[model samples]
Target chain A: MPKIKYIEENGKEHVVEVPVGWSVMEGAVKNLIPGIDADCGGACACATCHVYVDPAWNAKMPPMGDMEETMLDFAQDREATSRLSCQLKVTEAMDGLVVRMPKSQH
Target chain B: MSEQIVIIGAGQAAVQAVTTLKAEGFAGSIIMVGDEAYPPYQRPPLSKAYLLGKLERERLFLKADSFYPEAHCQMLLGVSARAIDRKAMTVLLSDGSRKPYDKLLIATGTRVRQIQVPGAELPGVHYLRSIADVDRLSPEIVAGKKLAVVGGGYIGLEVAAVAQKRGLEVTVFEALDRLMARAVSPQLSAFYEQAHRAEGVQFCFKTGVEAFEGHGKVERLRAGGKLYPADLVLVGIGAIPNVELAKEAGLTCQDGIVVDRFCTSVSDPAIFAAGDCTRHHGHNGEEIRLECVQNAIDQAKHAALAMLGKPTPYREVPWFWSDQYDLKLQIAGLSRPGDQLVVRGDPATRKFAVFHLREGKVACVEAVNAAPEYIVGRKLIADGTPIAAARLADTAIPMKNIV
Candidate 1:
């Protein structure tokens, strides 16, 4: 299990252990953490699950796909570190990962 | 007396209704009755990821199994409401029990439209509506299998895409002139046809299925004076709203159970309807029945608010999306008649958007692999903002600056 930290727009923090092969958005949603709506239900079709990854943990993740990249263009306050949480699958190496939810998704 | 809300149907809208009620400080008891054995799960993945085996069964759930209990809600799974006694303010269940409610919500959703042609009862024939439907069809989606898909709508095309990707010989039959004729523009239909064709998915347009020819199971589909040998047949003509329950209860039913902007039944304020089972009047005065997750979620939100006495009108900008191979088709707003179609970006690259403008305002936008347009288009539709056609057509202009 990968321990993931999710920080919401309202300064709430949720630290939970996510099973492998589950997306970051799923980890948040399954744990009942608010702010990551995942409206398309992890299809990466909607950008509602936008999150900002801590730069230190960015390198451990896989490169963004075209669909995820295109969807990130719609996220509010997008940054180089902005990623759709639904596209980021959890792995053992991603332990201690921290993702900040965008205010727009809140 | 503090009231309990009894919701019929345990789909997306029903779950949202309960969640909204709890989130809005409603301490009343919430009872959800669903015919399906599983808790509320997302339906979009049934034809795509779930069928392809990329997603697991448990992942499809909108919330964990413990969610209902944690929310202080009671769920009557695998049991359906047999009757609604409006005067008695109670629901008769399939298990021969009655549940009383001060308020009622009908969110029974829609059922898959079955093909009435001969041999439709074959074993290999399937309809992609519920988890059980896909569970039966998933085992048949193997490599090199012949798949004959009936109907070219979203479900049909989506299943075709998944089958094609799984190395299956896929052929789609459409009664319409083009694919997705009722929902998308012709340009999109043409684009999808070309894309699917490139993926080796054959299409037979202007063709209607006469019957399914096989022995004890579907082996061939007879359509348009031709026999297509198929190992599996997936029917996706469309869905019919589950309005019979409402109608039986003497509620006003048209295309769906008629509801107002607040999602309250036009005939009875104490009874409300939401999601696919509702024919509601939008802020623009159009009576439309939408069958999308967005509508299900938002309409439930409004219905919960109204039930709590907040009474906010359900005026959400309609948006929809589809996933075919690498292309993501996103649509926002509703296209009205005589809308000027503006092309932004070239479709040759498969990253373009079609902006439908009515009365010089952005009425609707269909974006293929263009997410910015969809995001901006949804906001533009919601705000009713006008934009210059030339500016909208120019790809260089940032979508955020259009308004």
Candidate 2:
């Protein structure tokens, strides 16, 4: 399991280990972490599971697909490293991956 | 003393309200009443992944068993809410107890519309709505078995896809002329009709079921004045909103439990309703009752806010998805009249999108195996973005660039 770090907008920190093949959105949702609503359950249909990836881990992660890039535009206050956590699959190489939640997921 | 909040129906909307209320610092005593024996779970995959044996039963649950108790909420399982007492602010349950509340939420959702025909109650006849429904029909989904499907809507087509993959002889019966007639455009319907046929699934157009004929079990269906042999029958015609409780309670029930933009009941201030059981006005000033997960989750949040004394109008874009085989059909925005469609990619390629434009503004989008259009199209619908028809139809320009 790759341990992932999740930071909420309120500056709350939660470090949890996510099993391989599970999504980062699942990592937050299954562990009862607040912030990511994930209304679609990792379908990539709803962008409610929006997150800001750490810039350092951007190059090490899989390139954002056309769908993820387009869906990111739906999230509020999107940035350069904005990604839909549902599209980010957990991997051993992504150990210690850091993701920050937006102010809200509405 | 803390306030008392009561939520009826332990599904997507019910769970969402419980989680949101706690997250928003509501110290009220929450009581969730559900008729099912299991916890609240996701129902979308029940027709697709779970039916095909790709997903296990445990994955259907929306939350773990421990999550509910940890939130300090009361769970009333295997109990149906019989009626609502608006005057007393109490809910009458099947267990003969009146659960009083300071705030009440009616998230009863919808029930599968049972087909009223002869031999309908025979064994092997199933409807997929809850976890038990799928479990009951799981064993009959064997190879070489004839499966008769009623209705060509999303659930019917999705189950057909799964049955086809599992080596079942599947045939869909739709009263309409095409597949998913009410939900998708004619172009997309034709595409799916062909796609399913190519994958060895049969379809019956303009066919209406007359009866289900068999001895002690459903072995054939009488439709279009013809008898079709079958070992199993799946009814996916449609659903009726579970609004009898509200109707009996004297709440304004018009097609569903009528609510304001804040998701509060029109008849009472302390009562709220969400999900498929709600009939509320949209941002466009039109009345609508949505049945998808998007409405369930978002409207539940708004209802939670209203219960927390932070009432905000619930107005947002409507979106839905259907996964069949390797193809994903995503739709955004509501249906409208007098809208013209512009095809983005060729259907022959099996990767395309249809953009519905009304007065040069994007009204709705139907994307098949094309996620970018569905994702970007949602924003266009939300922003009311206007664009040239030629530009939208041109494959050379990317969806993001067009906006």
Candidate 3:
């Protein structure tokens, strides 16, 4: 199991044990987190699963692909740390990694 | 260094455009003016899950409450953009305020087209478009009351599915020969019609609503020389683009606001249009307007890139999906009326994909309860890969191997 921590917009942190193959967005959704509405499922079409990655964990995550980047352009309140959680696959190196949900998932 | 980007309507397109602007490194002041009070939300679920009490109001929201401040986007709700002063680059609001903009995006979307029949304005006669519409109709759906849906299109069929699931007697009236005739193939429509009918949904195909017979509320619908008794009636004939504001502002307007391939207004460079309101020039030299969430998001991206001067031509394939009674019908690409359809798999087994071919090229695909085929079909349509009809119809050939 891969443990992941999500820091919501309200600054509350939740630690959940997720399967390695599932995306971070799937983990949040399956856990019934407050934010992260994956409207189009795991498809890169909708940007409702946007999250701001902790700068410390940026090196551990893969670079944002063109499709993910293009999808992120549709997310509200984007930042340099912004990444679509659906595109972020959970791995062992992602333990203790923190991600903040966007204020809006529109 | 204050550049202003004003979005005319605060629906999905406006919300996505603002988000895209921020992602693309636009530090300008973004303002979204919407006539509705609520923030951007998903409308597709209104007819299905939301109406059936399967989804809460919060679940239908596109963003949380903290979205506006976090995105640095100002949302002026319950305010309509009345007019546009092209020469001064300003938008006149209904509240007697004028906002200047360096660039403007018209995402007014569309309004439900109502049937012009007698008793059309009856109290119980409704059209589903906004959240309020769904909220008003939810109780009726849950009560398992009789519902007469006056169109066999996607909206009507979806509502019928939800109503039937909620134990209501649903009767869909379609003027066309079959359900979803304009958007789907005959075989696909027949499958849906059969599925819906199996779920106790009655249909009146090739029949038009002559009138609604009721005094204070809807009591019955007169169609096909017969009166179908009903407690409630919902008219889902179609939708017309909200192009009055654009037309009054001297913009090129035909069926919708005319825009180039880049989603820029053909008559003005600073003005761009997207979503259901703008008819952009398609690859086939036809001006087409799509009313899907995919189009809204993709067109918003195109418009945002164009506004930033990093223009990308809008060439993404349009796809749409509808959920009805355990069936997830996903469509990849657009198909015209006369397009050829080839079926893969068994319709009788309730699992199949119908491929629409144009000039022997794969033009579009409609899949029923087939997610993998829909995904591959989306990629194939986007790639414009020429697939042989025989190979497409062959079940042994995997869709992944078609590429």
Candidate 4:
């Protein structure tokens, strides 16, 4: 299991151990982490699951696909490191990855 | 004294009511009655991820299992609201009990419209509606099997996409001339038809399924004046609003439970309805019923506020999306007849948008793999912004800059 940290806009942090195949959005949703709406339920159709990734862990993950890139344009506080958490699948090498949630996601 | 709010049908709107009431600091008793065994869950993935076995049962839930109890709301799962005693402000349940409520919300949603044909009751024929429906259909969705899907709507096409990806031989039959004819524009329907064709999904347009023929179970279907062999038959024609309960309770029902802009029953102030079960007079003064998650969630929120005595008219721009074989279609606004259409991007690349204009103002937008257009198009529709046809067609002008 890869341990991932999710920080909310108010600075509240939740650290959960996610299975290798599950996405970060799934982990946060399963752990009942607030502010990560995942409104479209991880279909990447809705941008409610927007997350700002820590630059250090961003490189370790796969680059944003065209679909995810197009979806981020809907996020209220989109940043360069912003990604749809649903598209980011967890792997063994991604242990201790950190991402911040936007207030808009709530 | 805390007011008790009773919500019938624990689907998307029902669950949304529970959360909204609690978040808005409504110190009231919340009672949710659902006919399903589980709490409110997301149904979109049932045909996509859950059917493909990528999603688990627990994840289908809109909220974690414990959230309901932790929120101090009472849930009556595997039960239903049989009758509404408006005078007594109580609901008769299928379990021979009554639940009293100060306010009531009817979010019964819609039910799958089954194909009324011979051999419809066969074993291998399936209709995807509830979680249980998909559960029963999962084992049959295997590779090297033949699937004959009836109806070329979003649900039918989605099942075809999943089946195609699973290496199953898939064929779709649509009575209309094109796919998603009622929901999308002709350009998109043609685009999806081609996309699915490239994925080896066969399509029979302007055809209808007359009957299903097989031994004891479904083994073939008769459609388009020909009989096609099938291991399993899936029907996704569309859905009819669940309004019998409301209609029997003496509320006005037209197509759906007739409600005002506030989601309140036109005949009763104490009663409210939302989701696919509602037909409200929209901002445009037209009675409309939308079957989408966004409408369900937003309308439920509006109903909660109305119950709080802070009534806000439900006038949010309508939006919907569909996923099929790596193609995602996002639609916004309602397209009316006589609206002029403008194509924004090249359909050849499969990343484009079609905008509907009424009286020189943006009316509706259908975007395929175009996120910027959908995001901005929604805002434009909401604002009723006017745009020049040339500017909308010019992909060089960033979407955000158009408004």
Most DockQ-accurate candidate: 1
- Tens digit of per-residue lDDT, candidate 2, span B1-403: 7899999999999999999898887876899999999889899989988888876776667876777877778999999999888888899999999999999999999999999988899898999998899999989999999999999999999999999999999999999999988898889999999999999999889999999989999989999899999999999999999999889988899999999998999998999999999999875668999899989988999999999899998878889999998788899987675689889999998899998998888889999878778877877888888888899899899876986
Error of 2 at A78 (Å): 5.9
Q: Model 1, B353-386: lDDT tens per residue?
A: 9999888788899999888888888788878887
* lDDT score of residue B74 within candidate 3: 90
Q: Give candidate 2 misplaced runs (Cα > 4 Å).
A: A19-21, A52-66, A69-83, A88-98, A102-106
State each candidate's clash count: 0, 0, 0, 0
In candidate 4, what are the lDDT values of residues B156-245, reduced to their tens digit? Answer: 999999999999999998998999989988888899999999999999998989989888998898886788999998899999999988
Clash pairs (backbone) in predicted model 2: none
lDDT of 3 by residue, B40-158 (tens): 88788788777878666765666656666666789999999999999999999999999999999999999999889899988889899999998788767645589999899989988
| Count: clashes, candidate 4 | 0
lDDT by residue (tens digit), candidate 4, A1-106: 8899999889999998998888889889877787787768888887889999998988888888887887787678888799999999999998999999987873
Runs in model 4 with CA error above 4 Å? A1-3, A16-19, A92-95
How are the candidates ranked when ordered by DockQ, highest leading?
A: 1, 4, 2, 3
In order, what fnat does every candidate score?
A: 0.61, 0.50, 0.00, 0.57
DockQ of candidate 2, scored on C-alphas against the true complex (2 decimals): 0.51
Ten-residue segment with the worst summed lDDT in candidate 4 chain A? A30-39
**Relative to the unseen true structure, what is the C-alpha lDDT of residue B205 in candidate 2, on a scale of 0 to 100?**
93
Error at A45, model 2, angstroms: 1.0
Per-residue lDDT of candidate 1, residues A66-105 (tens digit): 8788677767789989999999989899999999988887
Clash pairs, candidate 1, are none
